[model samples]
Target chain A: MKTLRLLYMAEVKLSVREMSSVIFGILLPVGLMGLMGMFADTQLELIRAFAAIATIGLVSTGIMSLPLSLSSYREKKVLKRYKVTPISPTHLLAAHVLHCFSLSTLSMVLVFLVAWLGFGLEIVGSLWLFLGGYVFVMIAIHSIGMLVASVSPREKTTGAISSALFFPMFLLSGATIPLTILPEFMQTLAQIFPLTHGITILTDIATINEFNTVSFLILFVLTGICLMISVKTFKWE
Target chain B: MGEVIRVSGLTKRFGQKIAVQDLHLSVRAGSIFGLLGSNGAGKSTTIDCMLGTERADAGEIRILGTDPRANRRSLFQHVGVQFQESAFQSGLKVREICEITHSLYENPIDWQKTVAEFELSDKLKTTISDLSGGERQKLCILLAMMGRPKVIFLDELTTGLDPVARRDIWQTLLRLKQTGVTLFLTSHYMDEVEKLCDEILVIKGGKELIRGTAADVVHRTDSENMDEAFVKLVEEGIR
Candidate 1:
């Protein structure tokens, strides 16, 4: 736990010091949240129609931000440096996932605040359940990010790959569109992704207390499988 | 006495090109060992194998009397490695790098004293990215020496440094020898091998051409200088 804290502090300081990433990772998320809030009244009907739009934070950090961070570290040999040291890969990987988790949580809070203050949105769900589902979604999507980073040829290519994977997940996960109105094939394809299950369950419990045991089980299985594969396939150098 | 490093019948092949072939060596504690080879002669490959960064095709390697294949993390705790390139986060300060490395080892050298010895006290807070080539090399040595390691591996240690820095590092290596640390170093600079190494292994075409003390190898070639001796041995092999 102490080692995890040390690694987290190191990664956070390094990330904060890098201005370009800071702009995208921190400022951009806040800006996008604000942009959504600015039109929340007209969009409130649309957003509240499918409350999963609130999970844009999870997708941004997990699918886009985290992969780029890991890929960049690989390119810079930070991961390789850790390989030569006494640090275990599991600890390092845990630190990375924890860092992404914290960042995504922060982004979610910002978006929630904007929605509440601007659009008079109300979160009617159990806070603990929302947090659990949020963390699971972060872990599952961050696992995909690690998989992409491991396969990317270079850090420069991470952005293109992550962006390519990000938009579809965000749109189809009910962040930008309502899954209820989509065709059955699209919804089924989206269900294979954790974002759909995560947002669906999180919004259901938060707004209506409509818990689906099947969706929760699907999330657990997907998270378990991806976490195993990411841990097995991740390469430092 | 523990064997610091051992390799037997180690081979590395890159597609059709054989980098190292049928290599066998044992370095004992408290001795300075050298892997002398010219460009692309597979010195780095052998070092990589011992470091457990790359696997040997057909041989066994034990670092510090433990199989590196099985106990990489356990052995790594007592080993310090300096690569040829400036292989560090350049944006990090020298002091920060030292502190971070110290955290990794069970017993680390005093950072202030280490920096003073390297004449790097003035550059403690300076970012590695802003350092000169010689300064960066000194920083690398400083980091490698910080933990008072049992064994140190240096690959092409003086490649891109000025003469003064190279001489400073050689003097430091001699000091480290007095403290009874095993040193396994690879270099194309024959002069460096002659000055610092207690024993040298000359490798060419992925095989050992000769292995002996500096004086013994020079005497065998009937050459006054180590450079001329190396050339004579290589030329003889060509014939």
Candidate 2:
């Protein structure tokens, strides 16, 4: 327990030192929501924009920062160094997960606060459901990032692969453009992305006071599958 | 003194290439044991297998009378390893690295003493990326010794250091030896081996070519020094 706490503290320090992750994972989402407040004339539009910004924060950390950090650790032989110590690889990985989760929570809080103050956006649905959906979305996206990190053979390739998946998801998964604005074929294709379901559930609960059981189940199943694959395929070096 | 490390018939292969084959070794407590090999001679593979980082194809390894594979946690608690390619995160400060490593052991050495001995007291707040190659090597050595392990593995311990820094490390190592810590060292510097090792094993193509005290091997090969003896042993084959 003491070792885990020390590892966690180290991980948190490292995460804060990574300026790029801080900018993309926290600042950008809050800034985007603040900008959206100017153009959003209705409560529905304001809620959708805030939800999309939250999704952006999740993706930035989950799909971009998490995999990049894990792969870089492997490339640098940090994991290899830990293998010789009393601390197991599982402990190191757990520290990383806890660090990323904390970052996600901070990002979420910042985005929510900015949206509330700047645009007067309020959650009309059950707060418990909204919070539950947010947690599930974060886990599902981070699990996918873990899967990518585990399968990538090199740090350089991990970046290329993560960006390849991230850019498309960012552009089409209702985070940047609403599903109504996308072409019918694109909207249908977006359904395959976990982020699409995440944004849908979030916006539904926040704006319309509706809960979509199907989307929630889809997010849960995706999280489970990705988590299993990542654990089974993880490589220390 | 009891044997701190014992290996027998250790074999490891990477696909079609056999890295180490039918290897056997033993290191008595409180001794500096040197392992010499050409590039790709399986020195690293053997160390990796003994450290439980790699599984051997066939062999038995006992470190302090414990199987490294079956009792890895307990084995690691008493063993420190410095790898040739090991690295810390660039963003971490030297002090932060020391503190984190200090927390991993049951009874760690004083971090301040380690820093002063390694000459890293001035660089405590410096990030890893800002440290020189010699400083990084020193930091690695310091971290390995922080646990105060009974047996320590040093791979290429002085690869990128100046003569003065190398001498300092050698002095520190000798001090550790005086404290009854067993040293398992691998180095390309023949002079370093000749000066410090009580027993030396020279290997080629994953097999032992010769093993003895440094002076004994030199006399047996009819050479004046370790470099000459090593070349002759490799060229003329071990007699």
Candidate 3:
């Protein structure tokens, strides 16, 4: 669609024009993974470790940082200008969502490449499963980001709320500490957040042959719910 | 002439504060209409309601003979707007903003003409972050003009600009009117309302205080200028 193209171009231009976000979102993950891989004891350990690192990068970029930037733009009244034009609200939202998702995806690929080439890691499953899990996580997290942006009154508030929401998910999702090490209660609690299911899917793709359909389905449902709430709650003013 | 916009019994409330109350007005096609009120006078609220950006609790709005509430997309093509506090991507240049806006319309105006007329040719490559207040205002006006809508809404359009910049924009607005573009602009400047508007709507505390031609308001009140007439009307209340 012509509208889609315009939205894509706008997103690309806005992101690429200022290289800082790209550095933070795309290159930062790869750099962190490379450093960790160097210190990693073995190829298997490095591959196992990458799930957490990538999750951190993706969550920060897609959930916290991108939403803060957008809400700040709204607080500055930048988004109000679009209201007058023929461009619809859906187009603007789609562009921002695509921008964050693509950058986060690129970061994922870069980190995986480093893990594969630099550390000689092996993925035991179909590449499609890895890609699918990656896409699912990105959409689900991006939807949460939109919900954050929709409710945050100001950019500063967006930053605060995003961090508060993300850090607990980051630590408890079996990404950093394996679920096997956690107590029974904590392990049960982890299932409430999408990151738990998402990391489970990602690790399954990397360490095993088949995808975790239960985890994948749960994540897909969560993504849909977040997206609907985001659309319903978004305020233009 | 056709009625371009009609509002009857429009009211908007945010929690306990009513932003607009029983607002009624009509803007004829191909004419300049001004909304005059001081700060917190509900000028922006009224404009937002008409644009369907703010949902009114009670009322009817017919823009181009269709309900703006239910037919925003169709009405959007016929209406252009610039809000009171507008911002842009600081990295965007004036030329790019114009180009992007031009794409939104089915039949857009010439970007070349827009740039030349707005005197933005020299700043084509200038990023918005580096632009001064007047330059940003110029860009905003240019963005509004690109679509050549049948009606344009400008809220506090000249609040920050210097006199020279304001005059330039006024001239450009007049030129646009020559092409049969109806304008709905809001400002606190009485002289601006008197000079540019064929009819003025004075609002106070979220309601219509007075509506008539500049000369009619002035002559009816025996005031020397529109400002005095406005002050008298607000103080005495609309009888």
Candidate 4:
């Protein structure tokens, strides 16, 4: 427990020092939310905007930052350095997950506060259910990110692969443009992405109090599969 | 002296190329052992196999009477390694690296003393990437010694240091050798091998060209010194 705590603190401190967390995870999402909420002439538009904007942190951290950081460590041989110690690779992996998850939460909070205080945004459903849904979304997406890191043939290739998947999801998963505003065929195409279902879950729970069991189950099963593969095949160097 | 490490009939191949083939060696306890080889001669691969970071295609290895691949957690507490190319996080401070390494061990020495005695106290707050090459090398050494292991594996231990720093490290290593700690190192510097290694093994093309004391190798090659002996072997062709 103590070792985990120390590793966690070190991971957090290093991430903060890099300034990528504040820039992409926090500032970019918060800035985007502020801009999108401004043109909300009606409550329905405002709700759709928040629904889309809430996931920026999860997508950015899970698909972009997390995999890249792990790949960088491998490229630099930091993971190799850690392998000789008594500290298990499991410890290093767990600390990374916890650190990225917490950063995602902080990013979500800042975005939420902007919606609530600056624009009087309100969540109509149970906050507990919303929280559970939010956590599930994080785990599912983070699992996919970890799986990419595990399966990538080379350290430098992780960036290309992850960025290719990230931008389309970023723009269409409802952040830059709400999924509802798009035409029917594009929304159907967007359904292929994991982020779309995550947005669907958050939107359903926040606005309509509907659980969207299909989307929830998709994310749950995905989290299980990705986590299993990641654990079985992850490499240190 | 009891043998601390043993490798026999070890072979490793990368696709069509055999990196190491049918190699064998043993390091007795409390002696400074050196592995000297040219580039691409599979020195790193052999070390990796011995450390269990890389699997060997054939043969057996035992460190302290246990297989490293199957029993890392229990065995690594008594082992430390300084990799030739491994690095620390660039954003991390020296103290944080020390703290994390100290936490990883089941029984760690007082790292504070290690830092002060090595003259690294003033660099505690400095970022790892900001340290000079020699300073970084010193930091790597400090981290390797944190666990007070029975045996240490050092790859290119003094690749980037001045004369004074290199001699200081040599003195330090010799003192540690007196305290019953086994040292295993790979180096390109013949002078370092002649001055420090109690037993030396020189290899070419991943096969043992010669193994004995520096004096024995000099006598066998009919050379005047360790440098001439090594060059003579290289000129004679390993194949």
Candidate 5:
């Protein structure tokens, strides 16, 4: 327990010091939401933009930042070094997950604050439902990130694979460009991505006082599968 | 003195290649033991197996009277290891790394004292990415010693240090020895082994080629120095 706490504190410090994590995880989403607020002419547009900004935090941290850090740790043999200590590899991995989750939560809170203060946007849904969906989305996305980190042989390869996954998910998941604007085939294809379900769940809860039960179930199932595979395949070296 | 490390018939294989084959060795308490081998000679593989970081195909290892694999938590509480290519997180400061490592053991040395002893006080706030090679090696030593371990493994301990820094590290090791800590070290520098090791084991092709006191091995091989004895033993196939 003490070791975990120490590791968590160290991880938090390291995560905060990383400039790219700060830029992508916090700055990009909050900046996008602030920009959207200035141009959104309708309450619905503002709400959708706010919801999409929230998913941007999730996807950016989950797909881009989290895997990159884990793979870098592997590449540098940081994980291997820890294996010789009394601290278990599981503790190190849990610390990183908790650190990234906390960063994601902070980013979402900033997006909410900026949208509510600057754009006069309000969530019309059950706040409890929104929070619940948000947690599930984070779990699903982070699990996918862990899976990617575990399978990639090196940090550079993880970066390449994560970027390949990130851009398409960012564009077609109704985060940047709405699903209504996307071609029919693209919209259908987006359904295969966890990010699409995450954004849809958040937007539904924030706008309609409810969320899609199917998306919630799908995301929960995906989280379980990804977490299992990642744990099974994880290598300290 | 009780044996701190005991290994018998240790074997490890990677797919088709044997990494360590039928290896056996022992180290008495409070002694300095040197392990030497050429590249790919299973020095690291043996260390990995002994440290419980990798599984052995067949062997029994009793480290401090406990199987490292079965009792890792207890084993690690008393053992410290410095790997040849280990690294801390690049963004962590020297002090932050010290603090985190300090928390891992039940009884750790004072972090400030360790930093001072290692001449790392100046690098306390420096991130790992900004550290010089010798500074990084010093940090590794500081971390390994922080646990106040009963047995410490140092792999390529002075690989990147200058002569002054290497001498300082040698003095530190000698001090640790005076405190009754068992040292298991590997180095390419034969003089380091001659100066520090009470027992020396030279391996080639995953098998022991020579084992004795450094001077005894030199005398047995009829060589003038450890380096010459090492080459003669390897060339003569462990006679």
Candidate 6:
């Protein structure tokens, strides 16, 4: 427990010093939420916008910041340094995950406050179920990020792959532009992405007071596959 | 002195390539042991296998009397390793790097004092990626020493060091040995092995070519010097 705490403190320091997670993961989503609040019409529209924009934090931190850090560690041989230490490298990995998770949670809280205060959003739902779904969706998205980091052989490749995944997911997965704005074919194409299902479930649960089982099943299976492949192929050095 | 590290019949293969094969060695307490081999001669591989960086397909390795692979985390508390091509996260400052390493061990040396002793006080605030090669090497050495370990493994201990820095490190290593710390090192410099190592093992193609004192190896190879003996043995696996 002490080692884990030390690792977490070190991770927070190093991560904050870099500021990528803060800027992209936390601040970016908050900024985007403010922009979306300017156009929010009815209470339900404002409430649904919160669901879509909240997942931006997940994509930025999990898919972008998380893998980028791990890949850089591999690229710079930092992971090799941790491998020889008395603490298992997995402990360090947990620290990274925890750091990103905290940032994502913070982003969500800030976004909720902004939507409620700035836009007079009315969220009619089981808050507990919404919280549970939000946590699960965060885990699912992070697993995909871990998968990207695991499979990419180089830091450069990880960046390219992560960016390739990031822009489309952020744009089409309802994190930025609403999926309702897209044409029918584009929405169907967006449905192929795991993150799209995550955002859809969060939106449905928050605004309509219900879960989307099909989207839930899609994210669950995708999360399982991602976690399995990530575990099997993850490289330390 | 007791044997501090023991490797017997150790073999490791990466796909079809035999990286290390049936290699065996032992290092005594309070002594420096060197593993010498040409590039791709499996010297690093042997060190990696022993340090639990890579697992062996066959045989046994006991560092401080426990198998490294099965008990890496616990063993690492009593052991320190300096790799030839590894470094800390580039964004981390030297002081932060030291703190993280210091926190990993059950008991660590006073890293601040050691950093000052190693002439790294000025570099503490510098990000690791900005450090010069020699400075980075010193920081690595400082980190390895943080555990106050019983056995320290150094892979290519003086590869990039200048002549004066190399000699200074050799002296520091000798000083560490005097404190009853066992040293297991790998190097290509014959003079370094001759000067510092009590026992030297030379390997090629993942197999042991020779193991003895520098003079003994020269005598066995019918050569005038350790350098010549190394060349001859590489041409012929053993005398």
Per-candidate iRMS values, in order, are 2.1, 1.1, 2.1, 1.1, 1.2, 1.7
TM-score, model 2, chain B versus true chain B: 0.97
Residues A110-179 of candidate 5 have per-residue lDDT tens digits of 9999999998998899878888889889989989999999899999999999999999998888887778
TM-scores for all candidates: the values are 0.85, 0.97, 0.90, 0.95, 0.96, 0.94
User: Model-by-model lDDT, in order?
Assistant: 0.75, 0.87, 0.78, 0.85, 0.87, 0.87
Calculate each model's fnat, 2 decimals.
0.33, 0.75, 0.46, 0.75, 0.79, 0.75
Record all residue pairs in model 5 with backbone atoms less than 3 Å apart, i.e. clashing.
none
- The TM-score of candidate 6 is 0.94
Residues B1-239 of candidate 6: C-alpha lDDT, one tens digit per residue: 79999999999999999999998888888889999989999988888888888878998999999998898888899998998875666677888778888888888999999999889899889998888777777787788889989998888878977888788788878888898999999988888889999999888899888889998999999998888999899976557
lDDT, residue A18, candidate 4:
85
Q: After superposition, how far is residue A137 of candidate 6 from its true place, in Å?
A: 0.7
The TM-score measured for candidate 3 stands at: 0.90
Instruction: List candidate 4 segments past 4 Å from native.
Output: none
1 or 2, greater by DockQ:
2
Is candidate 2 or 6 superior in DockQ? 2
Candidate 4: tens digits of C-alpha lDDT, residues A91-175: 7778878998998888888888888888988888788888888898988999999998888867679989888889899887777
TM-score of chain A of 6: 0.96
Shift of residue B160 alpha carbon in model 6, Å: 1.7
What CAPRI class is candidate 5? medium
Residue B61 local lDDT, model 4: 95
Model 2 chain B: weakest 10-residue lDDT segment is B230-239
Runs in model 5 with CA error above 4 Å? B235-238
Instruction: Tell me how far the alpha carbon of residue B139 in candidate 1 is from the true structure, in angstroms, after superposition.
Output: 2.3
lDDT at A67 for candidate 6?
Answer: 92
Worst 10 residues of 1 chain B by lDDT: B84-93
Interface RMSD of 6: 1.7
> Per-residue lDDT for A1-237 in model 1, tens only?
655676677666666666544555456655655665555555435244324655666677678767887777667766665666666555666776777777777767766666667666666767677777677666767777877877787877989999888888867877666676799899889986677877777777777666767887887787677667776777777
